[model samples]
Target: MIRIVIVDDHPVVRDGLRGMFDGDDRFTVLGEAGDGREALAVTEAVTPDVILMDLRMPVLDGVSTIRELRSRGSSARVLVLTTYDTDSDVLPAIKAGATGYLLKDTPREDLFRAVLAAHRGESVLSPAVAGRLMGQLRSPAKEPLSHREIEVLTLIARGCTNRETAGRLFISEATVKTHLLHAYAKLGVRDRASAVATAIEQGLIRRD
Candidate 1:
């Protein structure tokens, strides 16, 4: 039997998943957690073969938890099971070391198959998620800058210092710097001037 740990913020969802797996002869429900932090603890203690993870939760989110798990050298394969299928949700989780991404609405049999595939160290993706990844591959555009990163670039183009940008955006100066750093990395520019210029050239922000 494959050992499994379910991670979801909702108790009902956790119970439902546990019941589903427990009813299956090929799988065993080893543990459950309400959020990512608790997931770390529970999975550490139980050492499950596969982890069913949710994307959104209090304390810590799924992607961060997956990264933490990988950093700690845990051998458990993570399989994301969440309601969200958007690019923002799917891309990060996959990049953070999820073995599979399945929508919550996946058929029971399909879910079981996905878990089996995950245990075998195979990649699994819901149809919608697979399409999104395909679209990303076909697109020639660079990684899109987030809205907040665009806001930071817009402020910088308007001659705002990091401190001034923080004041205008109602965020901390450190946060302003962090956004700038992210923007720089995404835009492939090393400094503020180049970031602003690239954002303008790409039409991500207004030159005026």
Candidate 2:
């Protein structure tokens, strides 16, 4: 049986996932966590083969958790199971070393298959997420913003000034300006406000 851990903020979601895994003969749920920080502790103790990680949570978010897991040299494969499939959500999770991305609405059998694939170290993505990735891959001319560019834009969208963004991101103001300029060019916008607007419109960043 494949060992697993479920991490999500909602108790209902956690219970549902735990029940699903419990009913499966091929899988065994080792633990569950209410949020990313708790997940880190639980996962360290149990050392599951696969982790079902939700993207948004209190204490720590999924992307940051994934990065921390990688940094700590955890061997568990992370399968992101969340409601979000936007570019901002998907790209960051994948970049932070998620093994798969599956929407919460995925059919039961498909989610099972995805978990198996993830345990085998295979890449799994829901159809919507896959399509988004393929579109980015095929759109060479349109050029998706780099991760740092997206980060700058996200902070800007949150109403942070250039100096504030730099301080928060631990980069120089000049570097922040440089990232914004590159983002403006890629987004076909000439200013911070327009770049933020375009990025939000394109789903490259969320307004909230």
Tell me, by lDDT, which candidate is best: 2
lDDT of 1 by residue, 1-208 (tens): 9999999999999999998999999999999999999999998999999999998999999999999999999999999999987666788898899999999999999999999999999999999999988987897877778899888889999999989999999999999999989988887789999998777755578768
Q: Score candidate 1 by TM-score against the native.
A: 0.72
RMSD (Å) of each candidate, 1 decimal: 8.4, 5.9
Question: Any idea how many clashes model 2 has?
Answer: 0
State residue 88's C-alpha deviation in candidate 1, in Å.
1.3
Q: Per-residue alpha-carbon lDDT of model 2 for 1-208, expressed as tens digits?
A: 9999999999999999989989999999999999899999999999999999999999999999999999999999999999988777899999999999999999999999999999999999999999999987897777779999999999988889999999999999999999998998999889888998879867788889
Off-target runs (Cα >4 Å) in candidate 2 are 141-198, 201-208
Over 4 Å off, model 1: 143-149, 152-208
Instruction: Give the CA lDDT, 0 to 100, for residue 94 in model 2.
Output: 96
Clashes of 1: 0
lDDT of each: 0.92, 0.93
